[model samples]
Target: MPVEEHDPFEDQFASALRQAGGTFESHRLDLAARGETRGRKIRRRRAAIAGGVTGVALVGLGGALVLPGIQTDGGRRHSVAGSPSAPPTPAASPTRPSAMSADDVVRTLERLLPKGKFSGEEGRGTGEQLPPYARVVYDDGKGKAAVAVMVDRVRPGGSQALETTACPDKVFVPYDACTSGRLADGSTLMILQGYEYPDRRVDTKLWSAELVTPKGQHISVQEWNAPAEKGAPVSRSRPPLSPDQLKMLAGAAAWRSVADAIPADPRVPTAEPSRSQGVPGGSVSATLATLLPKGAEVVKKGVADPGFGYVVIDDGKGASMVQVNVQADMSGLANQLFGSGSRTLPDGTRVATHQGPGDKGGRGVVMWTVDTMRPDGRRVVISAFNSGTQHTPATREAPALTPKQMETIATSERWFSRD
Candidate 1:
């Protein structure tokens, strides 16, 4: 299934948390818990709207929305944009690096850009209210566009680093084009050419380059066709910076220096854990493929995430989408999710099913879902949609899988077994 779109509620909650911050450590812990919950909700809702099940899926860059911080394995974190709210004062450390000045950040950005007239410049220095970042409206004699750069740290070789450099799934995020690969310096880079809106409600283009180094420095550079990321008319057909320009800007050494100067959170562990640790054995897509009923021709498959996978199939009638999420330790959410309408099996597994119109603005689309959870808190959710994608009109009357088939798949023992 397509990854869930950003939740407005989570954004509001995060903003509220930042504003009410006491210590950075406390805020980070609270936000991390909230983020995990929001992530689960997003996955569940996205699959439900597109097909039927709800669970945690991979994170997608829906509309390129700026997150306060991107959390990774080993408690590493990075910011995509600097916040305006006042930050908690850092405890004095003898080795604490001097903070970068806000002016220095803006100057570096201006210098990196091609010859252009800049206005509405804004910046936040390292170790300030938030991570270091620079934003400006630039006129390159062609048209005015908004450009921004943010620098921080990530867990080297962690899932967040991989996700940042991976192209978003077209099913969830419709983009013109995207490319990702590793640089000579062992840094992964991704350049995305997409619109500011996933639905293309507006033509304003949003192009971005994200680079994550082996040493954990992360640099993100974004450009918009309009003079602002949102709430502005398109000033040009596209952003000013070409893909090559964006790569150069994101790989600049200055950003690395800025990243290095940021103080490390004491709560984060020094030893990084393997990205695959604690995740389900094998890929979700691989396991889903084994569980699929006969005669369904797979057309496309979603990238594997910790607990999520999806596939588009055709049974010679029309294209349909099926997605599954396998999450562990979800017993805490059972009462809230299953409710009284759910049924209990002899094995003490809870099961719930639903059929409804898709909530993702797709026309004439229907989603069917079967959700199941074992007594051990191992939850498996499977959903199928009548359409190949959630954003498009329905191509079939119903999903390829019936409610009974989905229920069987959701309750299969293969989800928890390595074999």
Candidate 2:
């Protein structure tokens, strides 16, 4: 199913979350689900990477997952098992020489599987600019099921390592159960039982194993209830592999060897942020407090989120929430963002105002928003929610503030103080 892209403000918000480890339901726009009919997703939670839907193609930790230009990109790495020392080909080739060739990776997966009819194999050798992935259909006679393995690299140690295995905030990435642990070799691994749909609205079961070796190689294994990630009907009550099987597959030494062969970008010397790039959440909240209307009672606030912040307020009119985000250098997206419903100020600022249902679909919850950008492409967006959350019934008929009030906040000059 083709997902529509979100508005510019939302695009900035989602990008902030992705970059800062804050969580939001994937704008879902442009998410490639491969196959399936999708209605507007309700209670959607985001996967850490969006993983880009159908099957996650591994990119390293921190910043920029590829956008899909071709639909139906799957790693059908089907290579016949060959000797370990086979001569290699180009990086994009399904089979490339590594500690294990593409066929070696495929054969290793088959050997690891519990007895069954194995066919429809696919995998990539260590040679690709893209990560190496192995996929197979395994049938224990119940039905054909999909099992996949992807190997890449990650930053070793600290939050970056844990984030690779940590479950997403439940509010954004709902899952049944998840656990993280240390292997005997000191590697970090996490197993999660989740649904194909973020809301668990569907019965398609998805179970995954995420592991980061002490040396920073990342091996991710995902198994599904059907033969495909999306567009396929459930073939079983659960995926073919159990948690232990998944752990063994992702933790396989052979995948680590493949990861070792994959080249690293010489341009990026380290894996973590060189310095924090986001504004302190405290400053944002205090700044927002100054701009709020009188008679507002501040409820709670946090200072960890870099580029975004939120404040819940009450004025005896019931509880309403407000959020704002600031982004810089967005000039390139002007044409795609500023069109009808948008007007320009003499100062060369573009402003767009909108009133609509909350993005999360809280019952009777309305959202009043203002989006603005200076000619330099510095953007500010402010939105007011009628209810604390979209999933709940509204306490007020409309957002606490009017669109014009939000417009004032969004267009304020003080926001430029950050840059």
Candidate 3:
């Protein structure tokens, strides 16, 4: 019998060697045991196979699974999946930087800021709202400092809304404490004025700067700062707003800007609705007329479906039609999608199911979903339905379609004339 050689990494290679059978090559053993742990390696292989399956499905279905504008419970308001529905905007050019590194931005800001005998220290870069360009946060120790700065690229002109500090009880409608302005740079900056109640003292003033850098990129610097002493008089003194109340005001302003950016109609390039008709349609009436079962009350109306449109007619029993997206904002539709329980439609003919986050109906690459059922309880999933859980500025690529494309999507399927 030949003596067996002992390898230093034998234990690590043992499982793989056993699976490889009596004769194994040294290279094979090394390949299995090197770089990644055993479990990770297995998972990687599985993921690859899953990816291949997904690719096949996409090709077969003509990319319906990956539509743009899908909503999610997470901060994102739109789907990242490449869909033909919406194209992204062109990347704005990078602007000239005030400083190359975080340290530099901090140094420049410190030099520009007012100095005193206050205690404070500088901080590191969190991330660039834009790539390569970095954002640095600083604490002035006296509760005064610049929250962030954009050293490069400035976006061009647009009107921005500024709001005063007033927490509203009902957040659905617009609150009255804000104002909007168009900046000289064509980029609008909103200045939100703050005031103290009773005393009518100004608590702090905040503002956002939208600038179009020489290179055509857009950048906004948001900052706020409080008074020098407790109960001190607060006032708005100059341009480029102070960095006192940035943390409190940043969230609402950022998302509001994004909502403002979405066009009334995102589809164009074909025979759909004209530029004017695409604006968000009126609120969906939850009345009996619109809520009738697919074919019962009426038959043969066309509805918009994924990638194309289709028609359905109503039969007496219920309705015979493929479900399309119901046009209600994320709020009205969310409960129907993932509400705590189920509810019957206005017609009393259809009952729909609801599930929570991470549930089967709520899973997707870019957004969560909520599954609905027809009157008979058949499953139909509505993807990307979120009701204001959190928000981030929405970004778009080049326009996806023209007027012609929109018409094609809406009228592709026509229902037969009813008797």
Best by TM-score: 1
- lDDT for each residue of candidate 1 in 199-226, tens digit (9 for 90 to 100): 5767878788878999988787778899
Tens-digit lDDT track of model 3 for 1-419: 00001112222122222222222322221120021122122222111111111110011001112111223323212222344433343333343112123344345444444443222222222122111111222344444422333322212221111111112111111112443444344433332332211122333333343333222233334443433212434423422334333222332223232222322222211222221111133211111124333333333333222211112223333222222232212222233333345455554322333222311222121222223333332222222212211011111111112223222222221211111
lDDT of 1: 0.65
Total backbone collisions for each predicted model: 3, 11, 49
Residue 266 of candidate 1: its Cα lDDT? 49
Residue-level error in angstroms, candidate 1, position 328: 1.3
Model 1 segments beyond 4 Å from truth?
1-97, 101-103, 128-130, 272-280, 303-306, 355-359
CA shift of 395, model 3, Å: 36
* Model 2 TM-score on a 0 to 1 scale: 0.65
| Candidates 1 and 2, the one with greater lDDT | 1
Local distance difference test scores for all models? 0.65, 0.58, 0.25
**What's the candidate order when arranged by decreasing lDDT?**
1, 2, 3
Rank ordering of all candidates by TM-score, starting from the highest: 1, 2, 3
Q: Estimate the TM-score of every prediction.
A: 0.76, 0.65, 0.30
lDDT at position 307, candidate 1: 62
Q: Write the per-residue lDDT of candidate 2 for residues 13-44, one digit (tens) a residue.
A: 22122222322222221121110111112111
Sliding window of 10 residues with minimal summed lDDT for model 2:
34-43
